[model samples]
Target: MRYDLKVPFAEKDQAKKLGARWDAARKRWYIDEGLDPADFARWQPAPHDASSAAVSAPASRRAAPAGSEGTVQVGSRFVELPRMCDCLPWEDCDACRLQAWPK
Candidate 1:
């Protein structure tokens, strides 16, 4: 039997544990690498039709709420949009990832 488990990572808590901080301006988290500050950007979202949150993060993560059907961020604050999973950042959007099931 396949055992699926869920792990939890709180923003501030994660930042502390990972030695990073949440950048609200870009809505992404970054860890201090003792180098260029710009190098510590958060993960980019997956590409998909502008219809919902960019990539799917935990709902509990504090972030901008989605008003329309277009792409939006779930929990992450500094995640980038126009994400493409197989492109660069995300190999595929959450929707696309979910759709890519065994056929």
Candidate 2:
């Protein structure tokens, strides 16, 4: 399933790398976490088992599709959410650096 996503600024363009796709039937988008934007830009969802209606994204994928929500590497740990601010991390810092973090 290739579902389109409306990524909030927090998620940043990293969403672009995930190649988030829209699932019209589910009316929600999906993202693949394993994908590193610096390298690739697309992926397809596993075929849903028709026998079972439950949709299960990998634990890592489900935990955080976008790093903005904070990130978990390999999903062994989850980083804390960034603070609220004009920048992506929402932290107080040189506007110059923050602006470059993500947008």
Candidate 3:
């Protein structure tokens, strides 16, 4: 329910006066839940274009085909590895260790 804002650096003071909160973790400005988005219309991100192709997952985290396992060369033998989850590169779900990496 959070609403992220796209306030420009030059206008950060303006957004602050309008009650936008800074999210250090995400490095973006946002209005709290229950706040009316109409008041922050100018900073809102552009609407998603439906005509553009949707991204299923980032390439590094894309899962291997069903019933197949990926193998990596380990010294002398090939080691089979499980498919990875399709979580966002910036965020981690319960299954991945993406949180360990620096943002």
lDDT of each: 0.42, 0.47, 0.71
Candidate closer to the true structure by lDDT (higher is better), 2 or 3: 3
Q: What lDDT tens digits, residue by residue, belong to model 1 across residues 1-103?
A: 1111111254456434544555455455444435342332333222452312423456576575567447754775676455334544445567656655536
Q: Estimate the TM-score of every prediction.
A: 0.22, 0.21, 0.48
The predicted structure with the larger lDDT, 1 or 3, is 3
lDDT of 2 by residue, 2-91 (tens): 233344546545655456554567654554454343332232223552312225565576664555676534665756664544555545
Between the candidate structures 2 and 3, which one is better when assessed by TM-score? 3
TM-score of candidate 1 to 2 decimals: 0.22
Candidate 3 structure quality by residue, lDDT tens digits, 40-70? 9888777683212212345679887776677
Candidate 3, residue 92: CA error in Å? Answer: 28
Best by TM-score: 3
Q: How much is 85 displaced in model 1, in angstroms?
A: 53
Give the range of the ten consecutive residues with the poorest summed lDDT in model 1: 1-10
Pairs clashing in candidate 2? 2-21, 2-22, 3-21, 3-22, 4-21, 4-22, 85-90
| Model 3, position 81: C-alpha lDDT score | 52
For each of the candidates, give the backbone clash count: 17, 7, 0
